[model samples]
Target chain A: GEEVAQTPKHLVRGEGQKAKLYCAPIKGHSYVFWYQQVLKNEFKFLISFQNENVFDETGMPKERFSAKCLPNSPCSLEIQATKLEDSAVYFCASSQSTYGYTFGSGTRLTVV
Target chain B: LAKTTQPISMDSYEGQEVNITCSHNNIATNDYITWYQQFPSQGPRFIIQGYKTKVTNEVASLFIPADRKSSTLSLPRVSLSDTAVYYCLVGASTGGFKTIFGAGTRLFVKA
Candidate 1:
């Protein structure tokens, strides 16, 4: 079975500080996506990347959030000036094609 | 992408069949219905997907009627381990770059 790997299962940051989460797609997969789950609620799409290029980032907060996926390197989501509302579990997922997506356990960020 | 509606919660007994329904009245022709299951403190895992008619996998079965306005995910002989949050997503079948998720249904299986 293929698995998406994520680093730093837990992250704690002070408000107005910065936090970065990392994700590695399953071997041979090209598409990576980011989603946020707040209070164990719905999974909110943050961004999507096709290969090393960003396909869509409509859900991303441009002022404080950005993501990048470089070839042969794990993808990363960086958030600057974190707010209390930014506390949530950020998940990274990858798919060989567009049909199915495998998700990482996620990085839980707590902004204090 | 189409809006999906599902029950907020469901309760089932162990060893019984559990069926969760999702309604997507505005589904487009290129859209497909996909389901995912998530346990506590873990990310969602793909369960089953279907375009129309029926699709059955080792873990669950998906049934879609002719109208495609609604779909059902059927889990047979469910155990306690099957209890989790189930999400039904409707998105373009091919080259769908954007995916939207709904509130989903929380299933509780009891002994």
Candidate 2:
């Protein structure tokens, strides 16, 4: 029950191409979060949604990054005109009130 | 969001108890201290969390002082499989409840 599912375990896209990643939160969880990890460093929070509504998106790069968590569908993170710097692992997490987060296995995106 | 500082790395041997500490001096009243563990090429896993005093789970323990300035994650009887990067995060539910991750401490457990 504490499992967040992510699809496309690995993705390879050419520079300037578009990339999309999907995540399915645990059932009954209302909060979902997306994070980016690069070069085995710290995780950078990209965005979060509270019941399909944008809660905090301060970390999302406005230029080409966008996300949506729609009702009765999986959450998606899309990057347009992907850059080499954008190549990294994208992790999705879900949590309920006062409960700790459950993270997905992550999608490794390689932009060449 | 409260900033956290932790050791860059630590080394330990099997059967030893390892304690990794995190410092957050500017923690707010409602901020909660949380820890996560991450292995290579995988997503982070929640280890333990606490607001104040101490909290214990089957996997780990979280200890916070009265000042709420710092917290420590204690792992009992380490093994080689426990070697991973441990992250410390502090966030509040009042706001947007965004969790910010720090550099984290990489624990290398040697057999």
Of the candidates shown, which would achieve the greatest TM-score relative to the real structure? 1
Model 1, C-alpha of B70: deviation from truth (Å): 0.5
- Extract clashing residue pairs from model 2: none
* TM-score versus the correct structure, for each prediction: 0.97, 0.96
lDDT of 1 by residue, B1-111 (tens): 699999999999999999999999999998889999999889999998899999998999999999999999999999999999999999964442777788989999999
Please state the CAPRI-style docking class of candidate 1. Answer: medium
RMSD (Cα, Å) of candidate 1?
1.1
Residue A62 miss distance in model 2 (angstroms): 1.4
lDDT of the structure predicted as candidate 1: 0.91
- Name every residue pair that clashes in candidate 1: none
Question: What lDDT does candidate 1 reach at residue B6?
Answer: 92
Compose the digit string of candidate 1's lDDT tens values, residues A6-47: 989999999999999999999888788899999747778999
Query: By summed lDDT, which 10 consecutive residues of candidate 1 chain A come out lowest?
Result: A93-102
> In angstroms, how far off is A47's CA in candidate 2?
0.7
